[model samples]
Target chain A: MEKGLIAIAAALAVMTGMVTGIGEASVARQAVESIGKNPDAADKIRSMAILGAAISETCAIYGMLVAFLIIFVLGA
Target chain B: MRAVFELQGTVFYIIAVCLAILVFLIILNMKLKKFDPLDEPKGLVLMAMMGVNFIENMLKKDTNKEMTEKLGPYLAFLFIYIFIANISGLFGLTPPTSNYSVTLTLAAITCIMIEYYSIKYNGVKSYVKKLFEPLAPFVVINIISKVGTLLSLSLRLFGNIIAGSILMSVVYQLLARVSALIPVIGKFNFVGVIVCSVLHMYFDLFAGAMQTYLFGTLTVAFISNELPEEAKGK
Candidate 1:
């Protein structure tokens, strides 16, 4: 049961990373496109995109932490 | 746990000493008016700006060319100092930020300052209205976002500092073992030293500074946006 739980946790971590990566990539791409259309506002758009990416990346980090806890603490 | 500090003493001392040096430098700059360009001749304005730039670059100046320049440096200084203090734990010293009270207090102060300034600059009515920006439903979302900022900022700093410290410890242990195998390689400790130094600078210094700048800049951006147009014009 314990091993099964660890497997589930690890799989969830991978999925979290994938979902966050996709979300951030799309947001970043749209931000760049906006900047390309309006060069004068590039700095504002870029900063917003970076902020979004940073926030999104937190999910992946949390996922990794959960995976580590399951593997090391739960002995899975 | 008690012996942890014994191993991390060097890191602690370095951080403390660096902070002391920064404080001293600030005092010296103030006393000497080291980079003050208030009285420079017209042609020397550029030179004066360059002088200011040089000092700022060395001292890790967090000030930008905007009105918030007055507040940026102090915020940056606090973030960098706290970050180093937290990461010093990896060297075996206890992370000050690991104490929830410390991080919570910092976050509270930042949130309070943001709200206080916004209200001060925009008046209560405008400030309250800002909570409902874009749509009425956004009022709750905006309030939650403010709370989320406090939580996220504190957790992000705490998480990164702790992780960096742990990674440093693991890398040190692995390298120590690798050096044990090659007796001659032990003499040239530069490899390990260089790698460790680069990692520490990137993880602790660069990221620390970036986080500090982000915090301060975000505060300024949020408050300024909340300000009345006339006040912002000034």
Candidate 2:
């Protein structure tokens, strides 16, 4: 059971990283495209991108917490 | 396990450091030719917003004047700083505002500042009298309402950020398992990323900014209400 849980935790970490990376890429793309079309809106787009990326990372944090709980609390 | 700083002490330090950096940056930027020359840079613009908020209360204005003018910038700054702090969870840094002590101290400072200015602008007698007006024997209720501001502000900020962080972690873990079972679609984890990013932006950044603005505006309203009719120039 412990082995299984550890495997699960590892998987979760990877997923979190993947999700965060994808989210960041999309936001970056959108930001760049928007800036290219309207240089004047670059500041707004940058702020939005930052906000979008920060929000996107929430899932990763959730995954980490669960992995910790499983390891420490469940002793898995 | 050893306490480096008592929780409250740590909170005080965080607030002090944040405020000190804000003040120092403001003063330094003011002297820099580039900052003052044409249009202000984005970083300095954010800082200036904060500076305006800090000085908002100090500016004397009639009661009829819209309170936003005095409090808007400060509210904007509070939101920006608090939102940034809360979102620091993404980078694995413990959000200072996540701790109750930090929020409580911030609320307390705002409360004290509002009350102090109220009394200063209006003599003690009038200040006390204003509390009893439009209704009598409800002075205690009014005082409690004032104190309640701290509780509401602290809890709102703390609850939102904590919930967002906790939820994000949980979702990531669950999704990871699902993705593993379906290997073909696993290569594109774009959906998870987009969902998480949007949620963080809304809950942490957007909401956080709005909350900060509300808190600052509320403080201005609370203090302005205490000013005497003459002081209001009405």
Candidate 3:
């Protein structure tokens, strides 16, 4: 019963990724739109987009990290 | 080994591995000392030139000449050490960066440098003013964000390596299950060898290099950001 509860909790904790997915899509869309407008600045825009995306994904990573910690470390 | 030397295994392994790589790099660099880089270098000479050029170009682009000269060697050492540590997982040893002790030390040094240099370049008054910003309430957020940088930098590297190692173990377990359908080969992990090779390529080599690039680039970018705009040649 405790194992099941922990498992369910871990699953629910990762629901934060839903927001992350939407955020990632919007970031990509804007990056692509900007690149299209300024062809010459594509390299700079690409690097900026990657750095921005990586930052935006932090919350999702944190969520997964917490879930894993809860399931393995706390549940134990 | 432990009985003879009374040594802790992981600590000893980390030291020996790092020293071995350092020695190898030194020997390679020594061998290339006589080669002129402009004469269409090849082989080991070309590799050394590529590494030096990468660091020089990266530092030149990011910082002023004085700052570049001051910090270039430090950043280059950081880049090479981390690149090796990340890929060291391929040797079936614990990558030092995956250890929180190692990562925390690196991040703490970076954080201290960021704070120190920012204050030094901008002066205490301006640094405090920058923190307070257009509103007083933002100071709390500013402080939190500073801590955030340290946590994110360290955690990102640690979490990535640990997660990859965990997933690779899972892959091994799955491989064992699949191979169990066959004969005694299951005990020997026949399927694991094939699948793990591809997994290791993705996880260790490709991801390792990419993460090293991200870490190095972010270090330069963050340091540059901390400098005054005029100082940064903006």
Candidate 4:
């Protein structure tokens, strides 16, 4: 039962990426639209878009870290 | 033909490699300074300049204008150090970043810098004052945010690089086993090499560069965020 709980928790942890994926996709979509409208500023827009995406990526990273800690660090 | 000393631990190997890289970089800098005015810096010097400029531009985006020049080299070195640690896997060595302890140590340093600047430049009175401003109970939330930053930054680098290395190994084992079906090339690791090279390119090179950029960028952002703009003016 303890192992089952750990597995379920790990799955939920990985699911955090779903939200991040949607968030990043929306950011990319808007960045593409902005770049299309103003091609001259594409460089700046691209950098900003990447940084924004990375910030969102942090959530998924945290989730993975939690799963790792539960399975490995906690001796579960 | 003889060994003078035996290095037994991973930590020692990491120190040796990092020191070698630093020494090589110091020599490169010495060479860079003697360049003729008529010619552009080529090879290592040009790459070094580009790296510095990249970090400089990221920093210049901050509202605190003074930090761009002051913190530029420190953050750029952070990028280079982490980049090498991440890519060590490509050379058949364990990437230093694959270990949690190294990443945690780097994060600890970042946390120290963040707190030091937070209390030092912000002034202890204002630091305490601002925590209670808007509400007295917000101090706990503010402290949690600080711990959250340290955890997230270290773990992101650790998780991404280790996942890459693990997947690359799996790819290698699978390819080697599958290659045995070919009688002529059964004894060779060639298929494993060719297949795993493609995987390693993405896992190590691309991921390594991105992790380095993220780690350095986050460090700069954290430090500058803690520093008060008005206090930084002098």
Tell me how many residue pairs clash in candidate 3.
Answer: 0
User: Model 1 segments beyond 4 Å from truth?
Assistant: A1-15, A27-39, A58-76, B1-27, B34-102, B121-143, B184-191, B228-230
Per-residue lDDT value at B181 in model 3: 89
Local distance difference test, each candidate = 0.64, 0.64, 0.80, 0.81
TM-score of chain A of 4: 0.91
Better candidate number, 1 or 4, judged by DockQ: 4
lDDT winner, 3 or 4: 4
DockQ of predicted model 2 = 0.03
Model 3 C-alpha lDDT per residue in residues B122-199, reported as the tens digit of each score: 999999999998799999999999998887777777777777777988998999889988976567888998989999
Greater TM-score among 1 and 4 belongs to 4
Q: Give the TM-score of candidate 4.
A: 0.85
lDDT of 1 at B194: 64
Q: What does candidate 1's lDDT look like per residue over B3-88, in tens digits?
A: 65454434556556477557755765465554454755433355435545543442332223444455546555564556565455
DockQ of each: 0.27, 0.03, 0.45, 0.60
Q: Rank the candidates by DockQ, best first.
A: 4, 3, 1, 2
Model 4 misplacement above 4 A: A1-8, A39-47, A73-76, B1-9, B63-66, B229-234
Give the deviation of candidate 4 from the true structure as CA RMSD. 4.3
Off by over 4 Å in 3: B1-10
What are the models' TM-scores?
0.62, 0.55, 0.88, 0.85
